[model samples]
Target: MGAFSLEGYKPFMAMVTMHSILAVMNLLAKAAFQQGFSSLVFVVYRQSIATLALLPALFFLRGRSGVAGMSVSLRGFCLIFLAALFGGTGNKILHFLGLNLGNASLVSALSNLVPSTTFVMAASVGLENVQLRSLITWAKISGTLVCVGGIMILTFYKGPRILNSSNPYLNLGTALDSVHYRWVLAVGCLLVSTSCWSLLLILQVPICKYVDPLPQALWLCLLSSLQTAPIVFFLEPNLSAWKINTVTELWACLFAGIFGSAVCFYLQSWCISVRGPVYCAMFMPLYTLITVVLAAITLHEELHIGSLIGAVAIIGGLYIVLWGKAEDSKRERNHIVDASEITISIDDKEDNITGQPLLVNSTR
Candidate 1:
């Protein structure tokens, strides 16, 4: 490789920061759930808050730089609305439902499905190439399978705890344990959420290609908030549940709205603009790892042998997928170079055949 590019570094940093924020948000959201708020209410409040925060920024940026221009069709608007439906509201609702019902670690572990599902969706829609003859394609495909396998292992096998500790984070777990939920239902809900999230990522490329990411993110949040408002009002019948009772609930709403929704949505849309959905989806395992560590440290959640094994598999799979993606990029770059070289060679031959002296070699 030649000199490292700062352009490459930014996306990595963004993804890491996004995942870290999400981990903290998850913990806080879990706390808020334990604080007697329904998951639907939390999702509604989170998106509403994020929409309120991002709307002003969108208008400000729109006036100064015209950054929020979408230039999309009615169909495009429809597509965007669908994206918000799945990625924004549906994804949030399902994830929170699963998280509230199941272990946070389990929710994170299941997130490994996003990249795989996104890969399939992309290939199906012709957003991603699938070259059966290419080793890189096989690598990418196998990586996805491996990730799924890891998820299956985690789901089926709890194994022995690798490290069981009494920690400060266990307070949330203690409070949360009061509400019991079926493990299978939680897993099913999470898997569906993962699929919806995959669709959202896949759909965003077309939606954001001409549009600015910030504005697209704003629309997503706004549409999501609007869509979920009625559902929240109907489901959360207790008027008192709408009020922020504790400092923890306030922090949870604030952090989730600011970091998880606004910042994360913008970054995610931007990354998809820079590098398509598959590349962005590859970061899900990283998010999973961060959540696992945070849950362990704070919730005093046990690090099970199965989870350890699954995490290793997921990490290895992510590496393979990333390597394959890099290889594909390199191959494309080389193909372009080869085409340029061949064009130059033919032009030179034509010059010689025409008895025209080539003044200079114009190839770079």
Candidate 2:
């Protein structure tokens, strides 16, 4: 029962659920874009709805956790703004644009980059330690390299069609076939969006650990909405494009906001607090897999040989990275235990000589 319990695996379950939500969001976003919806407008509505959804709960839970009364320092506020800029608004903008240019499958297939990028970013920021001499270090580096290669394969190569076109009438073939300039644009946008997501994950670690996760999510969404509305207004200028004409468009907005933004941000913040960015990102391949299957079924998008091979490489490399982390962590725990034993031995020696016990601080 203990082995089968959810108690010890809550973080794992949370991440799986989080990515599943995101998978649905990608499909909705893709459908919305296909219907001539503007990416910027979609972002604005998504953020606005997310912010509004968080408002009532914010008031109700105000003093319970002292979250409402807590003051944000300049540094904390800056972090929130940066996170909004990159993770919330900008990430969505770029991703939606990429989705417009590409397909839902592309959006998820390339998502494997998040864990690789986050692992490196986390190590650089001192959240994760890197020991040069450790063999695990090489595994991390190699896995990162393999992950990048997998993404390259996904973007550049579509060897053969694996999943036949569900509808013979629909003519979306080898998703990347017609790409002349659009392919470059799509790949660039997707890669940059992945980087922004990685940075957002890193920034949230500290905020979620010290501050209230709920308010940070609120501020993040609110700031994102505030920041995006003006730019979208300036560039688009025409209010007509902002209109949600169809029911699908309206549904996309609500679903993306309530589930994708609000719930995802809260879940992501909690996951980051408990698991760190790399661990949180390790489930990204599942997102891609879900989107790939869903896209094929619903969108009638062709599933190709490249996607399968690339996905395998990406998932394999991800597990390699996880294995390296596990080994490194085991070594670290053993080292800590050995050091404590050594400290006790030295304390015993001093006590024998001085006839008095010596106090030792084992704080590392």
Report every candidate's CA lDDT.
0.78, 0.80
Off by over 4 Å in 2: 1-4, 62-70, 125-127, 166-177, 342-364
Which segments of candidate 1 are over 4 A away from where they belong? Answer: 1-8, 62-71, 165-181, 275-279, 342-364
TM-score of each: 0.84, 0.86
What CA RMSD would candidate 2 show? 6.8
List per-candidate RMSD values in Å: 6.4, 6.8
Candidate 1 residue-wise lDDT, 54-75, digit = tens = 8777778677464437456787
lDDT (tens digit, per residue) of candidate 2 on 1-364: 8876867698898899899998988888878888888888999999999999887777786755545444687788888889899998778889988887777777887788787788899899887778888789889889989988888777677677778654322222234344535755777898999999889878876666446777888899999999999988997899889999888899999999998999888888778777656577678888988888888788877777776787788888887888788787788889989888843334456547786547666784
